[model samples]
Target: MGRSPCCEKAHTNKGAWTKEEDQRLVAYINAHGEGCWRSLPKAAGLLRCGKSCRLRWINYLRPDLKRGNFTEEEDALIIHLHALLGNKWSLIAGRLPGRTDNEIKNHWNTHIKRKLLSKGVDPITHRPIDATDCERSEEKKAPRCPDLNLELCMDLPIEMQQEPECSVVPSSTTFLLLDYCRTSLQMN
Candidate 1:
């Protein structure tokens, strides 16, 4: 089978996009909005391939992009959304207005991971997935549910147990049920 070519070769006086090239790409996009990325390079008359052009436009050239550091609310949103959605960056980006998937992913890796690690939590599992937390939580749970099995976990609804966004619900309602599960089951 023919393998996919490694993305439109680089460093041929093409890696560093010039202002003139950016202008051409922007103008072309404005005149005729983005479509058929594979044909974009030929149509735009740029030395770069379609993929490169697309990355540049989406990541940097887009006028709607919100640049600079993320705010505290944005950070909370990321953590909250991550706990709910896992690593669905695209989905998370959809919730935050003006944020791009790339930006969100970078923020998650560089900043979020560091914070979680410091808090004695695993970045991947998010639920104390680190070795120490894993051992400790496991030990804590073992005494409580010596007979618990995968079947029980499988029977539970994901929204009820794991989805972080569900925390938004008022505590006066079914949230007490959630709290009950946390205390009784030690899920947190």
Candidate 2:
């Protein structure tokens, strides 16, 4: 059933790869190139299982991966993309070159999720950064005089009234607004 299993029986060898093993796997891939991972170990003369070799190459050895802390811009992009795409980490990773799905997923859960939450926004809904108990900021204030009706609005203090109403506006606008707000507030 299920072709037995992808990895070999346990306790044989696994986890925390070493330098020499890394070199052999890397060299083998470079020389012959990856096709069938099942055959890769035999060709590479490594004791590790084929699945292990594949995981190491994809998750670690790949040249395209971007190592180190994600820059501010990248983090901002990830947040925006995550908002639009949800927990689809692979798709998010696709948008940002050199970033891995696992890396992106980890960054999302560990960093971005908490950051969004700290700002009082629901990461999933991308709603206003308010506490969990806080109700929605009320339906869009009926758009203050609907079209500004300058002729009809002149009698009332439109500027004063409109300013406060707008200030109470919900942040359910663009995905980039929070990021922009974060940058502006931080810079100030």
Candidate 3:
């Protein structure tokens, strides 16, 4: 069976919210604060669905919301956050006080994306647009740590193993031993 609807869609008002509707929403929120969105419309005497009321309050009517054009610092911050967080708009919005997730997402698509492209940066990867395929592939590959030995050995322990006459050690082992010695010397 299909899931039940959130509200009586036939009865609720649609299209652009009137000024009175906005005022009513604001007054109701001011009186009772937020939450109980499923019943908010009934409580507020609004003809909007609970979802609509919640969205209007959050995306437009919220007092703490920062409206107007984004600042240069905000642009830089959004880019940095997007690089780390990707398309997680809500998480990105959390880092930026007063900015809503919807607002940030819209700005990213409408402005920041074009800005990045104009500067030769790929908005998705946050890398140079002209970067070679080899360079891109290199970024995808795991970095090698020459001094770290991750090989699993099923043989006997070094102490239990019979030493060869030549006592030759693997290159990786030699590199690790050298790194340890260097670290020890540096610490001392």
TM-score of each: 0.62, 0.67, 0.69
Q: Rank the candidates by lDDT, best first.
A: 3, 1, 2
- Please provide, for model 1 over 119-153, each residue's C-alpha lDDT reduced to its tens digit, 9 standing for 90 to 100: 87767666664476456546544533333322112
Ranking by TM-score: 3, 2, 1
TM-score of structure candidate 3: 0.69
Candidate 2 per-residue lDDT over residues 118-156, each given as its tens digit: 887778777665533233223342332333311112232
The parts of candidate 2 lying over 4 Å away from their true place are: 131-188
* Candidate-wise lDDT, in order: 0.74, 0.74, 0.83
Clashes of 3: 0
Could you tell me which 10 consecutive residues in candidate 3 have the lowest summed lDDT? 158-167
Q: C-alpha displacement of 31 in model 2, angstroms?
A: 0.7
lDDT, model 3, position 108: 98
lDDT of 3 by residue, 1-188 (tens): 99677799999999999999999999999999997988999998998898999999999999999989999999999999999889999999999999999999999999999999999988987877665755644543433334443333354553344531223356887777767766766776
The regions of model 1 sitting more than 4 angstroms off are 1-13, 128-188
Off by more than 4 A, model 3: 1-3, 131-188
Candidate 3, after superposition: displacement of residue 187 in Å?
A: 66
